[model samples]
Target: MKGLMVKDLRLLFSQKKTWLMYIMLCLMMSFSMQGAFIVGYTVMLAGVIGISTISYDQADNGMPFLLTLPTDRKGYVREKYLLCLLMEACGAAVGIILCEVTSLVKNGSGVPADDIRSAVVVIPVMLILVSFMAPINLKYGAEKARLVMMIAYGIIGAITASAVVLMQDIMPDLGHSALVKIKVFFDETLGGTYFWTVPVVLTVLSLAVMYVSYRISVRIVSNKEY
Candidate 1:
């Protein structure tokens, strides 16, 4: 398992595309003038880059070659998931540092503690997104899985929008006050001192998801004729 993970890391580091994505992330970080913008970009980039890593294997027909080695199917799948989570952590770290530096230079201090707190909320959400998508990618390959994930995301967006619209209709008196209240709740509860727990829970959940995904991928691949 360790050898397989090392090999995957080697392949990831040696790839031009990987470096290109990193460069793009760095450039984006440099241009982000606000902490909110930085956080948004970081979360978005992490998802895109992580999904691309999975797609690269499918696109390049690397899976068959990887399977031919002594590595087991579970090890292969687990390694990819682990690598993606590591990439997310790295991206988050870079983004936080960039935001701090930019804020210090432009405003004498980086984004406020509250803004930083709010940004931390995205960490678990991103992990949930990745965890949900990883098994789909492993089971269906990149293209099909992407299509399914897009549909899923669309449905989720629609549901959320509908809920918001319905709430507005039901509580005309509240106007946007409800949203303000919800935001305050999130800011004070989820984004406050409890924020640190998000990463810890996300890490644990992601590992659990990876384990399950690994088992499923192993079962699928082991039955294949290749």
Candidate 2:
């Protein structure tokens, strides 16, 4: 398993697509520091980076070659999922660093430690999305999986837009009362007492998703005749 993982990492790093992604991530991080665009740029860059890693296998017909080695099919599937998790973690770390540096440069002071907490929330959600998508790719291959993902993205965007519109319409009547209630809820329920739980819960969920994805990928790959 360790040997196969090392080989997969080697292949991942050696690919030009991987480095291209890294460069693009760095550029996005630089722009994201501008404060006008915070979450959008970071989330988009992370998504592209995750999808590009999955595409690497399809582009090179890597599976048949991978099967030529002594490793089991299950190991290959597991390695892919693990690699995605690592990539997401790395991307999140890079984003955090870039955000801090950008805040310092623009504001003449670092980003508040509290606001940094909000930015980190996206990392786990990104992992969950990637975890869910990995098995889809492993079972469906790149072309079909890309279509599925595109549709999913569209649905999420539409939902978000609708929710924003509804909120804008409702906000006039709710006025300061709604804002006060939200503040009180956050202060009472979501304050420092439960802040640490977000990452803990997300980590646990990501692990569960990773495990299920591994099993499903193994089943799909095992049935294939290489």
Top-lDDT structure, candidate number: 1
Off by over 4 Å in 1: 17-25, 170-225
What candidate 2 gets wrong by more than 4 Å, as runs, is 15-25, 28-51, 154-183
Instruction: Report lDDT (CA) for all predictions.
Output: 0.72, 0.70
What is the C-alpha lDDT profile of model 2 across 104-139, one tens digit per residue? 777878767556666666766776777668777777
- Model 1 local distance difference test score: 0.72
Question: Each model's TM-score, in the order given?
Answer: 0.77, 0.74
Cα lDDT, model 1, residue 153: 89
